[model samples]
Target: MTGSSRRDFLRDSAVIGAASLLAPATMVASTTSDGAPDVPGATAATTGLTPHPGPLHEVAQDEAYWKKVADQYRVTNAVTNLEAGYWGLMSQPVLAKYHEHIDRMNRENSYFARREFPALWRSARERVAQFVGAKPSEIALSRGATEALQALISQYNKVGAGDTVMYADLDYNAMQWAMNGLAKSVGAKVATLDIPEPATHANILEAYTRALDANPRTKLLLLTHCNNKTGLLLPVKDVATLARSRGVDVVVDAAHSFGQIPLSMDALGADFVGINLHKWIGAPVGAGAMYIREGRLDAIDLAHADESAPPTRIDSRLHTGTVNFATMMTIPDAIDFQQSIGIPQKGARLRFLRDRWVKAVRDVPGVDVLTPDDADLAGAITSFRLHGRGTSQANAAIARTLLEEFGLFTFQRNGIAKGDCVRVTPTLYNTPADADKLASAIKTIAARG
Candidate 1:
């Protein structure tokens, strides 16, 4: 937080805004236009293949391979970044391309803005729509998931006085704050249900079903496809089906789930879905998207923004004014990078690393695993608490000691019934060795008492 200057924030915001506006095709075009050689191992044809039996996993683990990927980033060696869930460091290709976009916009000025920005942004939306399995008209690019959810909730017409909006206690705090504010302003009621630790598909389904049943006036149900704190993956399809049966619209907060897992908005059956590309997709920060189902778009009002020719231009509504074309443009690169790794392979590797760490410390005498062990119920992230130390003191001590002693970075969440725990997340870039390092650090910390 100390090094973050206001000028730096404004510059990054501009880059991210531009990137969010331009579509994948335009990113490709802009890259080609700038004469920065094509991304190694990526081509239009190579972007659409499934993983085959081969050496990709071995390649993924190689230090040289990751170093080459890491070279794309401008990160310092000051800390081991285990906190990618909050924000992923940008890769070299994206960073370079982002600067290229900035230069282009600055060079061409109004000509590029008037002639090319619109077409490029439209193409980006179309590509994003295709990636998420939604129609182009249905997708809206947002600064982040918070804005998407805020827009949807603020614009939703049905939320009022007697209406109820149900969400879980484990959901992200920002959206919860927004929901609380909306409840106060619109005279709506907000109800929160407790999600059990070590959850199952049935446990989650039943909890939500009971919450909905208990609140007959519930008009909307908000659920995170993956809980930010515990990293518990909810049974979204099951919840969506049940919510639909009860005449409630399901707005899914998929901020952490979208690119982390293989996702298709159509198959999930949610009425609305919001995701952050900056997280798992590895797009630069300030990039997020929203999916409003066809025919259901009219149900929600649009937040105030400058309009284009068409009333249903969802991207125009979400992205307004002079925006950063660079960050949005890199979405295609990020998607291409993820696609090259293959979702299933990446997911398998993430799970393997997560399990390795969980198994190592799960049985420690004073340790308790807070997330569900079932793979279907979670991925990448796992949380736990020290038994005797409880929440506050345990979390503080662990956080301080880990950074001081082992150079391990982690997140802390307190006040849950299961006690305070550290959340360790492993991404595709992480190695089995990283997991071992984390496991060793946790064990050492636990032994101190």
Candidate 2:
């Protein structure tokens, strides 16, 4: 497509990515109106708890209040979607801001990107740093959590030939792959372990402790604050403390945990971490950040030996040549929307939706719920295996059956030691009714077997 045609096509679409929407550097800037006004009454005072009467736990059960929050998203009722773990739908307010940035970027082209974007980029990074309780010098923007993490793992300079690197079965698949590749490149050994079935505070800690004790030569350990496959929230602070005593440095993948839960760099107790802006914070696609604690930059080598920024700055850690400029600019709007609703309150509601279905089928004869009911252990994402059905094909059939027979959508996940499971993740757009529908569908399917 011609450049003008491509820009027009992107402008009409609901979700826009980084394409050639800009003109040549010498092109004169065109004056265009910013697309639309922000979402009405989307201020902090009206979003999260200001209008609710009781505390957060009580507010979670308040269906009327939640319905209002749900209206902010343009979700379809064609199917009861429970696969929000993949990525989040940008709220109307954030979406509007995104479109506005898109128009401005397209109109001004390279002129805006070259001269104006640097300051705006720094400001956006600062906002993310402030929201996550880290310093601006410690945060660097990336395409997503996976990009940031892969760079951190591959470029990590501490591992030696005889050392060991380790991860668990429940960790993200891409991250696990990165660990393996890192070990291979450095001639280091890879140690893999399983997160205990029926995971709880005590048993989970014991499993990690046992693995660490068994592998004394371990130098770098990877931790996922929230497991993507099972939504198992790890006790990172405790595990990081344990690893530190053994001289093992920890790198955390907080992709799903940062905005889904009440999280901060301080709470995680890990100096190196990667987070996603698009997942729970509701930013546009192609937005994420990495954190490297002050004085720890030397441990993570510069990306591709990039000298674009000084070695002391966090931006030197990775190089993403060209990115969605508009997406980066909308970071503050997404952060604002999330903060207006409050992370603690959002997490409580998500857990409430998760519990709504899990509680109903937990004791059923053929069903096995993988995530614990402990609010501290899991959030919106939960997975289950039916009648010990965990093979790739069996779980795929289960997921297909749910979609075809019950009009419910869920995803099948594999990697846990016990077996494969179908993951159900509810977001702000989902309601109590959707969770109940899922419960009924699962009960019927399990009964027929």
Candidate 3:
């Protein structure tokens, strides 16, 4: 098909699908009291029954119910967004709250920054702590996960010549870059363990344990809860427990796992944990967080604190100077939205969407599924490589064709040396029909080649 013709086809198809998807929710008039939808059983009962009267099992599969949740997000009109792992598009409620925060901050000016900002930040921190099952004092707000990771890494006072830091090949590039720079400046060794495709919990834990055993000087171990590319879920709690027993502190990069799965930072037993709210929480871009154990707070250098500042104040070190309050304010809203729907239900829905898409293409002649099919080993994100196609060539061709020809937006996972794959991430807003479209597109592309 010609480019224009392809665009037209996608446009027409999306319009029909979008309308059908949104009609149920749009038809329900908003009640003025809380501005929440006036659905049946809108209020929770005394028995703590969920407002929606249905079996928990049935609620997750209800197409109209999920569409109502999806309608909250004002996504781009031109494409089916499957790239939420990189950055989540904000929902209408969050965006509206964020704008109100911006206007309030602007109106109050320096007064807000000096007087009101501290209180607001504390509230945000408390909400985040509750959301992730950590102590409020233990959490520190950061611009994003990268900054949080950097803040944790910058704490070591002595690393010259003999010390080493270990991380897996699946770690995020930004964290990898920071580790490399630290190695150069401190003369510390950087070691990486190669993780296999479709890795199991046992395999991943064994690789890290072996790496730590080999490198006696390994002072800190960094691991991601889920890889951005492969979407492979690591046994973080087990790894942390093992590493701690070996006298090594563990820092978890939870950018991909935080909102995508159920998490409790304290329960995981990691020395440090960092996550990006923009990806899974559906918060405004630029919102993220870091957690440090209370007693261990004094170990890290304060990146923005003055010499006179208290050594034990974790937030002081991480929350220095002026910040975007509007973005920060949206964190709670996102958290509430997620909580209202319930984490387990949301997770199941996401997994269902992922499995539906993966199953459709798994047997295709040239496709190699990189993510584990087991639900425990995966959630939301899934990757697959096309046989006989190199990373750059396949990723470029597929990504271009999907957007230009099919109106699907996805992340190209070609740069990683391991294998080439296209990553598809479906959020609460995504429907089974969306999965069908993706499967059809991938099948078409594979057949053409």
Candidate 4:
């Protein structure tokens, strides 16, 4: 499609609230007669795709084997990227499918959007819902995790005049902002506290217990399945059960965890949740989903209930007026790719890479790994600090030095409360060698200190 035609479709689609204009695009998840999984519009090469290739426990540790998988991404070698938590780059297979969608969208233009885009969007949403374990009716598409989370927090209507809302330091920063704003919107009190420094299951649970006990009127709790800053995975299901027993509702921010690890509404036991398809799911950026347990939609008010669609409609809850149609269309392709590789393999590889780096640097003099020792409490993301380098500036300096002098790229994060630290996140594209390089660079930096 030409630049002008793209603009026309965006304009026309937004006006119609129409997602696509194809010929009743009917993408289904039907298997072949031989029982092989068949995904529509995913004609990308299937050479590396495998649902099960022996035990993933062994495959996850096979660096050479994963290196071949890493070759599928067009990763830059100019700098060792340890910041994959921000957003994931699509694999070549998924990227190819994305380009095909882009080209198709351009070709069909308004003709496609007006005629068949709705069904195509449904197929995408349905597939995403299936991947995340929810009915299509319970899911709504959003720009990303932030938008879905903000909408969930802002629309939370269960709060009475003096009810309280609470969040912890581990929650995403923007999500904290939304929770804080609840005080004004619901005329509710806002409670905030920090998670334990040397995070332990007992201490983490104790922190929430103290906050909720102190605030008897706590009606809503914001929980992060996996924190962005430090990569701490909270006890979401346990916390949700505790809150529900106390007459408190929970809204889970699963932006980083949903795709990184296996997730399902039944597994999380949350009434409301917002997750990103772009983060660990490997879809192109600008894709996310929101969930409100089917029977409990009345707890949150809709954004454009009366103005656009009714509050009863889940999609109307978030106003995705115009979006990257190609990106949205590519979610099924990404899901297919992820399923083929297997979530267990994907997560195990991430944990393997994380352990590779942490195990190496944990003993370095003046080097402190901030993430917890419990394997279950963390994922691919981890953080560390120089013994005396507790200030944000010091951590930033270490990160900058690693990037400039050692040719390693890393980023700094605050809210550790114990100390500012540098975070390292490895993706599927990363290899064990990358982890060794990061570990070596950190040791060198620590020795120089």
Sliding window of 10 residues with minimal summed lDDT for model 3: 17-26
**Candidate 2 segments whose C-alpha is farther than 4 A from its true place:** 1-53
C-alpha lDDT (0 to 100) for residue 102 of candidate 1: 70
Candidate 1 per-residue C-alpha lDDT over 355-379 given as tens digits, one digit per residue, 9 for 90 to 100: 8889999898777777777868878
Q: Write the residue-wise lDDT of candidate 3 on 1-449 in tens digits.
A: 23333223222132222111001122323433433333331211111212244664576678877866776655666799888788886655556566677788889876655445555566677788888888887888888898898878766444567789888777888788777777777889898888866588788778887898999888778888888878888878888888888788888899877778777886567878888888888888888888887788766677654332345667545643456777776677677656667777777788888988899998999877788887678999988777756567768778889889999988787545586678889897788999999999989888886
The per-candidate count of clashes, in order, stands at: 14, 0, 0, 6
Q: In terms of TM-score, which candidate is stronger, 2 or 3?
A: 2
Per-residue C-alpha lDDT of model 4 across residues 301-394, encoded as one tens digit per residue: 8775533544576755777676678888888878877786778888888998899999998878899887885977988899899976879889
What's the CA RMSD for each of the models?
7.1, 7.9, 11.6, 6.3
Alpha-carbon TM-score of each model against the true structure: 0.84, 0.90, 0.86, 0.89
At residue 229, give the lDDT of candidate 1: 84
Ranking by lDDT: 2, 4, 3, 1
How many steric overlaps does candidate 4 have? 6
Using TM-score, give the best candidate's number.
2
What Cα-based lDDT does every candidate model obtain?
Answer: 0.70, 0.84, 0.73, 0.80
**Runs in model 4 with CA error above 4 Å?**
1-45
